[model samples]
Target chain A: MRNTQVIQVEGLTKKFGDFVAVDHISFEVEKGEIFGFLGANGAGKTTAMRMLTGLSKPSSGKGKVAGFDVLKESERIKERIGYMSQKFSLYEDLTVKENIRFYGGIYGLSKNQIRTKTSQILEELQLSEVGAKPVRSLPLGWKQRLAFAVSMVHEPEIVFLDEPTGGVDPNVRRQFWEAIYQASELGRTIFVTTHYMDEAEYCDRISIMVSGMIKALDSPDNLKKQF
Target chain B: MRRLRFLIQKEFIQIFRNKALLPMMTLLPIIQLIILSNAASNEVKDVRIAVVDHDQSEISRALSNKIMANDRFSLLAAPFNKKEALDLMQLDEVDIVLEVPPDFEKQLYRGEAPQLQTLVNAINGQQATVGSGYLNGIIATLNKEIRRNEPLFFSGLPKHNEPVVVTSNNWYNPELDYPHFMAPGILAELTALLTIVLTAMNTVREREIGTIEQINVTPIKKWEFILGKLVPFLCLGLVLLTVGLIASKLIFDIPIRGNIGLIFAYAVVNLICVLGFGLLISNFAETQQQAIFVAFFFVLIFVLMCGLFTPIDSMPKWAQYATIPNPLAHFISVSRKVLLKGSGLADIKMEFVYTFILALLFNAAAVWSYKKQE
Candidate 1:
């Protein structure tokens, strides 16, 4: 519970009826760090992520994300964070630029701010050529990149990406990782979940969950040596 | 306001661009308006009748001739036996059967009253009663003729007999033209259909496509998100109302005697109630198909209970009270009053208040049902 810790959880648990998706798990993600959350299918990675992102409430325990109380200040926490799902989530019917504008507007950016940031993001992602095209027409890799950029349009303090590169090719995945690195270099924290073990090496710190509990938390190299 | 404007723009583009939705949204309403209008007529015409003549006398033949001359009833075939008449009724070929009993002429001449048996199919009870009235009139005329020629002494006749003295004045719809009654109703129906589908589909579609979570994590307040989804459909509903009104005036020549402004105002209020219901359905449903099914069930019930097919006054006492909160009933009653009966706001003030209060109540329920988290 240092001031520098962006996300602090103590015995965070979620239960749907009698089933416990995420048991009493405790972890902290530091500011400006790429923290990888790894778990098997249905291993409570998503449930824990939902609670931390303020999308779902924990049945027991307490947590804080970005200096806001998870239960009472959920909306305030939402305003400071961005989220992207496993699916390349963007409005398929809207153009890339329109999607960015919509998300930026909802994040309370002024019209001028949206315009400026949209141009910059499009340029940074090398999407200037197809920015006017519908998101559905873009390749899966491009849509994922655009979604990531759209999530960060308001320049939130942190971004949560749940399996952000699920179905893309290896070359595209490499490029997507570069974008993540670029965001981290800009002093933004990245909370990412993935099943690909190799992707865990790219994170500064990694946590592996098994049966609703965090079994290991360390650098990929340290985790390998310990095992 | 700016966030809502952007969301509205996005929704409109999605609706306009979808290939399957464009035709369904635009063409379906027009086609339903034309077809249902024709089927909605209350004027009964071309009734079929089977005659069973047990007596081949001149009086029996004369009775058949009078029924045929009335222009309402069409004789199905030559006189059949009693068995044949019952067979035709069971086969659904004829709606009514006229049985002329044996010795009918002998009983009339012997100073005794003769009864002509009229057996009617009462499946559609209203039509059956009207048909029976027509048949009884023909037999009464035959009795008068028999009395006039013979000059028989009848001492105990009812005193309240006035010949040829029946007149009918149908209120609201003088001609009872189906289109005149149905066009306004269909317009109201279209509002409910379109608003429910659009609003309910708005959030659920986002959930399916994965954008809902992204938006949820943004700074957008819940009310802003909900309003963003609602305002576009409200505008579209108004546009549809205008198109329907123009079609009513130009194509069908449906009169609009009340204030046009008042009608438009009522339409706006009614849209709120429908859109609110749509939002509530969207919140409860986890998928697009579920939202659609839920909305369809409510719309079907609403249309049935709205007094479109049955008179509100004639409904059972409990059912009549239940329809008071159904916005469709209020809108239909107000539209019929304004367009057909030429009623002013003063005449339909109660209906207006009912619609307005229900709209607010439904919207409140919708806002309450929407959760800020999960």
Candidate 2:
């Protein structure tokens, strides 16, 4: 497999009328790399993430996500990447297995592929017992982990997780990180944004965005020495 | 196409998961459709009459024959005594009572006026007034015939002092069954209510639960998402509309005068106009409660101004003109003309054109309001 840049940006800026949400920011992530985006609250981390995910229009600058243009190629970007927002974005009304099947099916998976993935995910996540029950009945930690797994069901090139471990217990968060590393082993690039500084250690290289601009881009040891 | 099937499947599951909302969406509109259509009629058909004939002569029998033959009055019991006639009137079985006095023909032959006593139950003023007028008409004709034959008594009387009679024909609704007017209107109301409320609430609910954000980040196009949402409601609305028409036909006996296929086609076109209105409301409203209120506001305007309860011709010219833009009004008019009159496509071609344009306009507006990258 070619180890090339999966995400390349020159200067991506998003403005809301008089206010600038995401200033001209530039970065790149190699294939299968777990790149961490660290920022304080209101630091335009989300605006940058949205632009990269092709969910929001960039006011200026040019970028390519998963080899697709950020402008005029958003649909292609969506097909190539998986996204999980901070809101525990799963169908609470749907069962764990059903949620897996639905998300997979929406990515244009065939019936045979959906069936295979459903069983594989159930055993892998150890959610075989409650596959028929609704997601609303599950514990918060379990839901977050299941959400991560569902996001990656279609086996996209990259998984964009925005605060994926928010409000989960320490035990569950550790197990969740184990799965994140496991995903990287399968050559899925992980682009995550988090306020938890400790989570920054898991990245191959971390970029700290302050007020929509990248102030630091280096390994954790280097960043720690500077701070 | 496969993506849309999955998306629509998810929507159906979400809707059915809430046990209460599903039944409420399908049931309330149906109940309202049947009950309101039956209750909307105002034309009075059966007015019972009782005749007390003390003057059992040829004239009295002829008078009784004339009264009974008219469609307005039904003969209850022609009692010989006033007491018996009054008894039937008191029982609420009869609306009018006519009493011919004992000295009937003898007084008229002696060149003296013979009085006829008629009493009307004025409990419902409209029935009482109209009933009495009918009686007066029948008696006046008798009086004119009597005067013409007895020319000796009227030789001194002036001829110009005659009752200037006018005749009227019920051009459209001759039988005056109010159900005929309301069935079409009620069908219009149900389509708007079901389409707007269901679509609005579900759309907003998706936003509230954050599922919309998940779908937004997917490969689904904005127009694809909108179409996926609209197609399900369109299908469900059509099924519900068919059921509503069947019930109207079975319960109220509303005749289907226009093309049966045309009626369904008309409703589908109407759905095209209205389902987008719901989508537009959902796009603007951030919460399900806000969606409900916004939907209610627009649905109320559409239903009330559809001329369902009031006749469009009776409305002010400006308000009548406003109905031009109201989809519900066009629906009601189309249904009534087709169902009751069996009016062909040629007769209702203008309505079809206007509705088609309005539907296209509304759908375009709805699609325009949605932002994939705003």
Candidate 3:
């Protein structure tokens, strides 16, 4: 149960009927490290991330996240990890503060914790003025940032982001990387998937996948040199 | 439990915040109950009658007078013959044609039974059935009067051969108010429609917006999620039922004759049954539009077979058996039995058991079909 190896997987695989989405993939993510999964649009990055986050059942694999088995103890795994999906997943009709409070509450936060966390998120995201406004009114960049913050409200050991910077501008993507870095500094492992090369450069280690298999695994600079 | 509290709270906030849905869920159903109760009546009054008096005798005139004397029957025409009366009926001017045959008075005087034929328009089944029943009652009373006044004519027959008078009193609803019979069923129906549509649309909407992916990754259990969705809508259904009850009392003076708590007890189980059915439908649907169509499909079947407007006994045998599993049918039956007939728990324990079993089955299917991993 050491914190060093927060995520460890061996021969992880997922299949849809006869189609293999994620082939026999193996990897490990250390605490406080930013791990990036780089692949093309249909490269099984999302499928693999879904298995790790307990959002999908892997076809075959030995995997662990935050000291819990991915297949046998997914509920426990869910409790110890955070996931922000590829789509904008927050409630658009709810107020900014209400969204934060709701996610925090579902994650078993105390009332006082939600109270303080609401204010902290508003202040940190500079959303205090629009705290009462519905999230549908927020800009895309602001909404993505708030989604990331809400995902980490439970302070889990690992946060999984699936193409978290898919459609935002470069300026907002840079701000999003800053949020990732801040989370890594807080000793939360960052497991993110993206095809953006610049975003990949921010990860401590990167795995580039082709089809369903990881073609290369190395530091971004080493990957650049090898390629 | 606390997680469930948060889920329910968030649901309520979203439900109330949606301007279009709020009024539709609350105000619209109440208005429907008020307006529909008055408009959807089965009371057969002012039946248009056309008499064809061929005999032109004293008894034929007496019969026509007796038919018209009742408040329910209205005289439309006094045709000279049966063909003229049939013409009036064909023109859609009258609902019934009472014919007095040529030997009508002569047959009675000769101690033979005279034929009195009545032709009824069978369109609008309820109006036809009840109007015919009223006509029969009036004729029976007239026959009894004739027999009593002309006892000497019946002296040849034995005492036991005389007509046996059967008196029928309608219990619970002495006056046979259509709204009194209809309000409780309408209340159950509207509550059911609201719960089913809302519950069916809820999860599909989350899936449509991709929020389900986020929820699937959370630590919340599947039962907790389903229960969370059900609880809020269950409360709304109960609130609607209460509102309907009050409106029925205020507007229709419908009696709440049974134990009031028992009504709510049955309502909770029935509403849960409806909610589970809705969730099961949502699990099969991938989008809100699909959910709505699927929900509407089932709701239509539920309402038509629920024995609300039509008697279940009159349904085709197979269709009547289909209502065995229909929770709405059972709910409306229990509603009328308890609210109108003053039925106690022992009297309706069978309905309670069946509704409870349906609830469990629907909820189990809903929970099983709602796969987080898939």
* Model 2 ranges with Cα > 4 A deviation: A1-3, B38-166, B169-173
Q: Write the per-residue lDDT of candidate 3 for residues B156-234, one digit (tens) a residue.
A: 7667756676878999999888889888999999999988998898889999999988888999888989999999999
User: Largest lDDT belongs to which candidate?
Assistant: 3
Better of 1 and 3 by DockQ: 3
Return the DockQ of model 1: 0.75
Best by DockQ: 3
TM-score of chain B of each: 0.90, 0.71, 0.94
- The alpha-carbon lDDT assigned to residue A62 of candidate 2 equals 95
Residue pairs in clash, model 3: none
Tens-digit lDDT track for model 1 on A17-65? 9999999999899999999999888889988898888889889999999
lDDT of 2: 0.85
Answer with 1 or 2, whichever has the higher TM-score.
1
Q: After superposition, how far is residue A92 of candidate 3 from its true place, in Å?
A: 2.1
Segments of candidate 3 deviating more than 4 angstroms: A1-3, B75-93, B148-161, B313-321
Cα lDDT tens digits for candidate 2, B1-374: 88888888887787678888656656776788778877665445667889899988888887888888888888888987889888888899899999999878878666466899889999977688888888888888888887887789777766776668778886455666777778778877887788888898888888888888888888876677888888888887887788788878877787786799988888888887888888988999999899999888878887788888878898899999999888888888888888888888888888889889988887787778887666
Scoring only the A-chain of each prediction against the true A-chain gives TM-scores of 0.98, 0.97, 0.98
State the lDDT of candidate 3 residue by residue for A1-227, as single tens digits: 35589889999998888998899999888888899999999999999999998888988979999999999999899898899999999999999999998999899999999999999999999999999999999999999999999999988889999999989999999999999998889889999999998889999999998889999999999988987
Chain B only: TM-score of model 2: 0.71
